[model samples]
Target: MSYVQQVMEQAIKRSPNEPEFHQALKEVLESLEPVIAKHPEYEKAGILERLVEPERVIMFRVPWVDDKGNVQVNRGFRVQFNSAIGPYKGGLRLHPSVNLGIIKFLGFEQIFKNSLTGLPIGGGKGGSDFDPKGKSDNEIMKFCQSFMTELCKHIGADTDVPAGDIGVGGREIGYMFGQYKRVRNLFEGVLTGKGLTYGGSLVRTEATGYGLVYLMDEAIKDIGKSFKGATVVISGSGNVSIYAAEKAMQLGANVVALSDSNGYIYDKNGIDLKTVKQLKEIERRRIKDYLEFHPKAEYKEGFEGIWTIPCDIALPCATQNELNEESAKALVANKCFAVGEGANMPSTPEAVKVFHANKIIFAPGKAANAGGVATSALEMSQNSMRYSWTFEEVDAKLKDIMVNIYRNASSAAKEYGCEGNLVVGANIAGFLKVANTMLAHGVI
Candidate 1:
């Protein structure tokens, strides 16, 4: 068997049952075939083997008390996947679905995502299986404290910096930061995604979504197309979706849909950003509540049905594997020309294949959803300098970073003779940086 295939087989053998991690591994390694051929030294150095195996995996039990004085135990994980280039960086996700396999997949993806950002940050991801939904503020705070109490040991401003993901957000970040400070007795930028009042940088909240749109705009503009008057359907009503919808609209696109895990809402007349923010950001209610405000909008019971909506552009800002092969075909059949991922591995490999076969402009998550981590790095810089950039300044820098990502990915794809296949382009470009860095550092 080939070196890449051998490495993949061993990875699966060692990490059995981690389907998500296996899938992420296959996607990136398969794309590196051309690069591997060009650099036989990578195999000699066992870079593929070392790259797949995380440098460190921290797993601990988090014990917290509920509002009723009942003790609850949850599992926490931190996969410090790679730090060849710089410090480990990623987010901490808190959700019922979070597990070792999921965190490994996210961390593996982050290795490339962070590299693509052209920032001096390595890759890592940590989170817990503790569901913050329906938990009171006190209960959530206790969990964050418990989770951070142990996490603080493996992380620092110059070591590993974690932001927020999924169920972990500003509120949770605040709780965890407070705990980290108390435990470490140091006030540093060990975490990103902080609120502005403390040390958060401006435009950090909107960075991911805005960055997704900016990259998509660059991709589409290359084909002489623009967001103006385009019908855009974005899944998820969270930060990425909301801000993507906002920016798409700012560029003159008519965003018609947004969804949550429970279901989706389609506003044929265009989504009202205000109402979505109120319903989701403020009220923290189900997406079905969106219909009460916009009574004319249609609410569906299933999330997959959102893909059937006709549109010129589709942004899957939801969870991993939310969009499948069937959804990709449906979008293609409906004349959807472009798809940008705003979530980690949101599109299944089959879905990505369908998009490529249908000639859809597809942007993989590592490159497309990288805005969040890239901005998190920016926040770290701000925290280190003890200064903050204005919203416009931060936003401008984010746009430039995203644009360069697209250009570099596009150039890499063309150079490798895979022109327009951004999945391969992004993987190759991201791998070269880390692989070269690994080689220069010798076998760790």
Candidate 2:
């Protein structure tokens, strides 16, 4: 068997029951065949084997008291996957679905994602299987404190700086940062996505979503296409989805749909992102609540149906594996020309294959959704200097970084004789940097 196949088999054998991590590894490793051939020294140094294994995995128990005086317990995890390039950097996701395997998958993806940003941050992810929905503010604060009490010991401003993910947002970050301060007794930039008053950077809120559109705008431009007057379908109603819709509409695309965990709302007249931001950001309501504002709009119960709305561009900004083979075929049948992932591994491997087969412009999450972490690095710089930039300044820098990411990925693809295949391009481009850094570090 080949080196890549050998690593795949061995990794799966050693780490069974981690299908998410396996899937992530498969996607990246398969794309590294050309790179591996070009550098047999990488195999000699066992870079592939070490790359898949995390440097450290921390598991702890979080015990907190709810508002009703009831004690609750949840398992917490932080997988510090790699730090060859720089310190560990990723997000802490809070949800009922969080587990070691899930965090591993996210951290594995983060290594490449952070590397693609050309920033001095490594890969790590931490979270718990705690559900925050419908929880009282006190309960959430207690839980955040408990989670950070342990997490703070393993991270630092210069060591591992975590941002927000899925259920963990400004509120959670605030609670955790406060707790980290109380526990460590030192206020520093240990986390990104902080409230603006507390060392947060501008443009951080809209980075990922806007960055996705920016990358897509660049990719489609190479093919004589743009978001101008194009029909766009974006999934998720959270920060990423809302901002992506906002930017796409600003760029003249008609955003027809946005969804949440419950269902999706479609408006052929173009989605009013103002109402969406109000509902999701302020009211914390479901997408169905959107119809209450616009009676003429349509709401569907199933999220999978969102892809069938027929659009020129589809941005999957939801959770992992949210888009499957069926959804991919549906989008292609509708003549969708581009699919940009605003979420980590939002599209399945099979779905990616379908897009490639149809000659669709597929921007992998590591490249397309990198704006969030890229901006997080920017936030880190601001924190280090005790200064912040204006919104326009940060946004301009973000756009430049995103454009460079697209150019680097495209150039990498062309160099590897796979021009127009951004999946391979992004993977190769991201891996080479980390791999060479690992080599320089001398098997540490």
Candidate 3:
């Protein structure tokens, strides 16, 4: 077996039952075959071995009280995976699915994702098994405070900086930032996704979604195609999906679909961004509620069936592994030309295979969905400078960054003999930077 294959097998042996981590490692390791063959020194130095393990894994108990005055407890984590280039940066995802395995998977993927942006930030991820879905504001606030009390020890303005992901959003960031300030007795850019009144950067909320679309726009445009008058299917109804829809519409693409955990909504007349934002962001209602406003639209029962909808492009903005091989084949059969991921690892390995095999213009989440963290790093820069840029300025910078990322990934793929294989290209491009940095600093 090859070194890549051996390392993957060893990783599985070391971390059994960590399917997500295994999946991430497999994808990255598989891509590194060409890279490793070129640089045998990386393997000789045990870079891959050290890179697989986090530098620090913090796990703690978070105790809080509900509005009913009942004592509650939740687990918290901060997987500072690697800081070869700069401080550890990722997001805190508050969901029931939060676990060490899932967080490590996210953190591992982040190591490369952050590198892909050509930013000075490293990789890390954290979250809790606490579900904020049905919690009241006060209860969530208490939970955030308790979670940060322990978290404050491991993070800072120049150290580990976290932003929002999934269940953790503007509200959650506010609660956590307030608690971090209270406990640390210091105010700093320790967190991104903050509200405008604080250290938050403009366009941070819409960065990932906008960036995802930006990457896709570059992809299709490379093939002499454009979003103008193209039919696009975007999954998810959260910040990523909502803003992606808005940007696609702005670019003249017809976004005809969006979804949530319960189901998906399809409107042949195109998705109403205003309605989606109001229903999901403001009201926190299910996507089915979208049908109440657009009575002419159709509501399906499951998210999987969404792939059957024909479109020129498909953006999987929902949770990880939400799209599978079956759905990918369905997309290919429907003659879908592109697939962009707005969420991390939203596509399974099998699904990715189908996209590549069919020659679909596939944009990996790390390269395509990196705008959020890139903007967070920008927010950190602004906080240090004690100033903020206008919306247009930050947005223009973001667009430039996305364009560069697309070019770098595309170029890296071609250079590495996998022309147009962004999965390999993104992984190699990201890994090469961090690995070289690691090599220069010497192994830790």
Candidate 4:
């Protein structure tokens, strides 16, 4: 075993209960073994240890009054993992699954993901164990306000900037931003994913999904293939899945599947993106609602079944570990040539192994999903300049950034003797940038 791996194993042994931190460090160090061998300075500088452990993890209670005139409290967390490259930046997800483990894993991955974007942003993630679903608008607003009340103390445009993820969208961001403005008594760009009227950047909503498709385009191009007439099955109906489907369709790919937490829908005639947009974006309804517009579609009750359908590309834009070894085998069995992750660690290590063994073009989340944070960094840039670009301009920039990220990952993999292995490439590319920055800045 390499020295860095050994050190990480020891660290994991010391904190056995911290699964999120362990998962993050394991994935990162596994691909970085060769890097550590080449650069002993990383070990001497204790970069691995620092990278595994967040600089600060803040957890607090979010107490609020619901619309029903009852007091409720929720747990909140913010894992500020690193700031060597720039300030802490990541999204805030609102779901019952939010915890220290999830936040740490997200933050650790964010460090590398942000670095891969070639942006001047470090890594951080924050959220609360507050499920926004089934809540009245007033209830969600109250919860968001309470959550931001504690979060604003540690975030700013120049410090850590939070964006939207999963259950946290424009509504949640607006509530949180309002709370931050109320507390700080300033209208700064303290949070991203804001409404257009605020200091929000254009194309921020479509960045992650659009970026995923852009990366997929690069991957296919690397293999002398293209998305033209390709069939794609994408899991999750959230922002990432939605925009990914839209962009893939625009690129001449037929997207046949999309899902939510409950289940997925498969339409052989290709999913109607406009219908999906109305159901998900406007009505905030379930994926099953697509049947109302397209009755011929098949609605399956679980997301796991999405893998059974045959397709040329698979994009797991859902939650972490959504794709397991069985799903990976299914994709390979069904002749899937490309898989891009739009969610953080959406594929398990075993699934990744399966894809690697099959020689599939697999792009890791740290690189594929880096577009969200990259656009957040763009939002930060606009905020710094007090200027907002048009939607077309911001989208053009996002595409360029995603293309560059794929090139960087591809080049890093080739240099590290792992050509065509994006997991290794992404880890090395991101780690080198952060490690070099940390070394240059000295131990903090």
- Ten contiguous residues with the weakest lDDT in model 2: 277-286
Q: Write the per-residue lDDT of candidate 1 for residues 1-444, one digit (tens) a residue.
A: 899999999999999999999999999999998899999999999999999999999999999899998989999999999999899999999989999999999999999999999999999998999998899989999999999999999999999999999998899999999999999999999999999988998999999999999999999998888999999999999999999999999999999999999899999999999999998899899888988888999999989999999999999998999999999999999999999999999999999999999889999999998999999999999999999999899999999999999999999999999999999999999999999999999999
RMSD of each: 0.6, 0.7, 0.8, 1.0
Which lDDT values do the candidates have, in the order given?
A: 0.95, 0.95, 0.93, 0.90
Candidate 1 yields a Cα-based lDDT of 0.95
**CA lDDT of 247 in candidate 1?**
95
List, residue by residue over 147-166, the lDDT tens digit for candidate 4.
Answer: 98888899988889988987
Candidate 2 Cα deviation (angstroms), residue 282: 0.7
- Candidate 3, superposed: residue stretches over 4 Å from native: none
Q: Return the TM-score for each candidate structure.
A: 0.99, 0.99, 0.99, 0.98
Task: State the lDDT of candidate 3 residue by residue for 262-367, as single tens digits.
Answer: 8999999898889888888898999999878999999998999898899999999999999999999999999999999999999999999999998999999999
Instruction: Show where candidate 2 strays beyond 4 Å.
Output: none
Q: List the residue pairs that clash in candidate 2.
A: none
Q: Return whichever of 1 and 2 wins on lDDT.
A: 2
